[model samples]
Target: MTSTSARVGGIRKEVDAQKLGPALLIASSLVLAIRTARWPATSDEGLANVEWQKEVEHSGHIAKAMLSHLISRYPSLFLLKDVPWYVPTDEDVPE
Candidate 1:
């Protein structure tokens, strides 16, 4: 019974460790999004900055989509270089 309990405790610790990094990342992303959303845009330049930021964010989404495609469709492209280990090879892209 103690051995079974110890095994369960070890698994719980491993799962918690795995969850911690992604949880921290999500928290940081939320903080950054909130900070950006709260940015003041009083002047004309500030408004332009906001527009530019919007465009930049759109481009970022496109870039991420393209990257996902490249990674999923052509996994061999990263054979020579170190690819992100977290990105699963079998990740499906929408048709």
Candidate 2:
């Protein structure tokens, strides 16, 4: 009986641990969604769009231009080298 109780307790702990990950992921996504929805569009966002258009017009890819912009704006987060360019849509501009 004692071993059965211990086994049940261990299973409960494992289930709780597995639940923790998805719960945290859902919570984080909710927070991010709320924050992004609440964020006001800035002039920089528009500027970035114009810059992107110009770059794409001048060349084929806006990767270099975006890299420069990211370097200037968010240097810490910027990965200038070997960065994966995954634009969501052709009309989707950087902010």
Candidate 3:
């Protein structure tokens, strides 16, 4: 009986760990959308800025992380060879 309960508890923990990351990711995204929905959607510049910020936030994080990893492995390619690293849909460097 104790072994059966332990096995169930272990499975429960594994399932919880696997689910928690995605659950947190989705929850945070929903919370962000709810909070930012208050912004005025009228002006052209304001809307554009919001879109741009979203792009920068999402793309920039992914791009920078990838670039940093590549740089770590192949420093010569970036530093000495002058290879231009490009990120997807990245027009300009994020500030």
Q: What's each prediction's clash count?
A: 0, 0, 0
Q: Rank the candidates by TM-score, best first.
A: 1, 3, 2
- lDDT at 3 for candidate 2? 24
Look at candidate 3 and tell me the lDDT of residue 56: 45
Worst 10 residues of 3 by lDDT: 5-14
Residue 18 accuracy (lDDT) in model 3: 34
Cα displacement (angstroms), candidate 2, residue 95, comes to 67
Candidates in order, TM-scores: namely 0.34, 0.26, 0.32
Best by lDDT: 3
lDDT of each: 0.45, 0.42, 0.46
Clashing pairs in 1: none
Candidate 2 Cα outliers beyond 4 Å, as residue runs: 1-15, 40-95
Q: Provide the RMSD of all predictions against the true structure, rounded to 1 decimal.
A: 14.5, 21.6, 21.4
lDDT of each residue in 6-88, candidate 2, tens digit only: 11112111122233344445544554455457556666744456643553344422333544465567655522233233424
RMSD to the native, candidate 1? 14.5
lDDT of 2: 0.42
lDDT of 2 at 85: 39
Candidate 1 wrongly placed segments (more than 4 Å): 1-48, 79-95
